[model samples]
Target: MSSLENILYFQSALGFLANMVLLLFFIFIILDHRPKPMDLISFQLTFVHIMMFLIGGNSWLADIFESLNIKNDIKCKVTFYSSRVMRGLSICITCLLSVAQAVTISPSTSLLAKFKQKHKKYIINALFYIWILNLSVSSDMMFYVVGFTNVSETKQMQVTKSCSLLPMSSIIRGLNFTLSTSRDVFLVAVMLTTSTYMVNILHRHQRKLKHLHSISHLRASPEKRATQTILLLVLVFVVMYWVDIIISLTSFLLWMYDPVILTIQKFVIYAYPTITPLVKISSDKRIINVLKSLQSKCHQIF
Candidate 1:
């Protein structure tokens, strides 16, 4: 097999393993909670991420099978379509999560604060809209994607029999890129802005506590901890996502499919879902307690 094929296989295997770990962590979070609004959003994101891993991983696996003279068009198409849907949904859900987090941290006096009280139903509604919007936008791919044989002549190769919204005419591709980039920028801005305000609020609250000689300074209250955790997660997300974006954009502008850029993008995309579970484990006492209980039970069983 060619070196390019070998690298693809290795990256896909790594992504699959990482996604499995992320799935297990999110499952732990779900089993330990009664599905708060935030939990629901996290669960949705995790599910999509797993779907992405499966779809992308399967495509790579299919390549290996084909190289060994095995043909499975049905499996290839299924993997391609599933991957497309999952990727679209992943992007939509990321935006939903940012909006949800912003609403959660909004001041009670702010109009957005109403979401805190009435979020469950609204979240359901918004999720429905996101799925519909993504499905509509990505439907064009179903017509263009054919198996490897069809794309063997093209510079932009298809890993499997899947269609992407990306390999269109330059004008169309630019439009799609603009839309995707704008959505990401807007979501990141919202997350950073709301998180910054929340941190400031927590800081002011801390200063007020300092003025009270009767009250002792604590390590960190639940609200403060949550605020800090959210801030850290957002920072990690912004840095990782923008780095991937910059690499991708630079590659596109240079009209080159640089292997280094592809590798970095793959890692960032695979790692994104792991962040939420890590944030919860670090910030939520209930989740930590559940993990501890599970560990003790396992030890006893052994």
Candidate 2:
């Protein structure tokens, strides 16, 4: 196999492995004695991550299909649409997760805290809307996507099928790009602002507690732990997303549509969702206990 094929294979294997681990981690979280609201959110996030991985894995499979000279139109469309929907869903859920965490950690005086009693229910409602919004924005792509045979002659020599948005006037393409970019920037700003507020509140809360007690450690409290976990999750999300945005923007500005850059973008996008469940498992005591119990049961069975 060529180097490109090998690279795709390795990446696909890694993505699949990560998805399996995330699935197992979330399962343990769900089986825990007392799952928290955050744990449930993490569970839902990880489920979406698994779907993202599966969708990404299809890209690698498409490569393999090309290597085998399999030219199937239905397979191409299914892969294309599934990947697009999964990507859209992943982005929406990630923003939702950030908003959920912010609400969870908001100070009592904050307007968001007024809805504390109904936070989980609100999150559920928000999640429903996120999926709907994503679907509405992306559904038009269904009419535009076509397999290899339908693309321009310049791209016809490519073995793997191409799925692209239909050609539009330059003005229309510009408008589409502008709208998409504006929405993305707005969501990113919201996530960043909310995360920053949460971190500041957590810091002030920790300092206040520290001043009140010199002899007692402040790290052992459930609230403190939850705050730390959310902060860490937010930090990870921000860093990964910003890196992706930088790379994507550079690629777009340079007009360099290299497959390698696209590959890297896919890696980052898939990695974001997949890591969330594992992070939750590592930080959550109840999930750790459940995983331990499962390990013990498996050993006994063996």
What tens-digit string does per-residue lDDT give for candidate 2 at 1-302?
35655665566566566657656766655675455566556666667666767666676667777888876655566676666666666656666767777777777888988878987777778777877787677655455445655445433222232643344555664565577667777777787777787778777877888888864565557766766676676677778777887886675443345566676676666556655655665767765676688799999999
Residue 203, candidate 2: C-alpha displacement in angstroms? 1.2
TM-scores of all predicted structures: 0.74, 0.80
Q: Write the per-residue lDDT of candidate 1 for residues 1-302, one digit (tens) a residue.
A: 35655665665565555555555666776686567776676667767876776666665666776787755554555566676677667756766665677677667888888778789889888888888877676665455455545433464544323432235577865775787678778777877777777777777777787777546665787656766766776777778788878876776554455445565566676565555555555577866676688899999999
Model 2 ranges with Cα > 4 A deviation: 1-12, 28-34, 59-73, 150-166, 215-217, 246-256
Total backbone collisions for each predicted model? 0, 0
- Lowest summed lDDT window (length 10), candidate 1: 157-166
Best by TM-score: 2
| RMSD (CA, angstroms), candidate 1 | 4.7
Extract clashing residue pairs from model 1.
none
| Alpha-carbon deviation at 215 in model 2, angstroms | 5.5
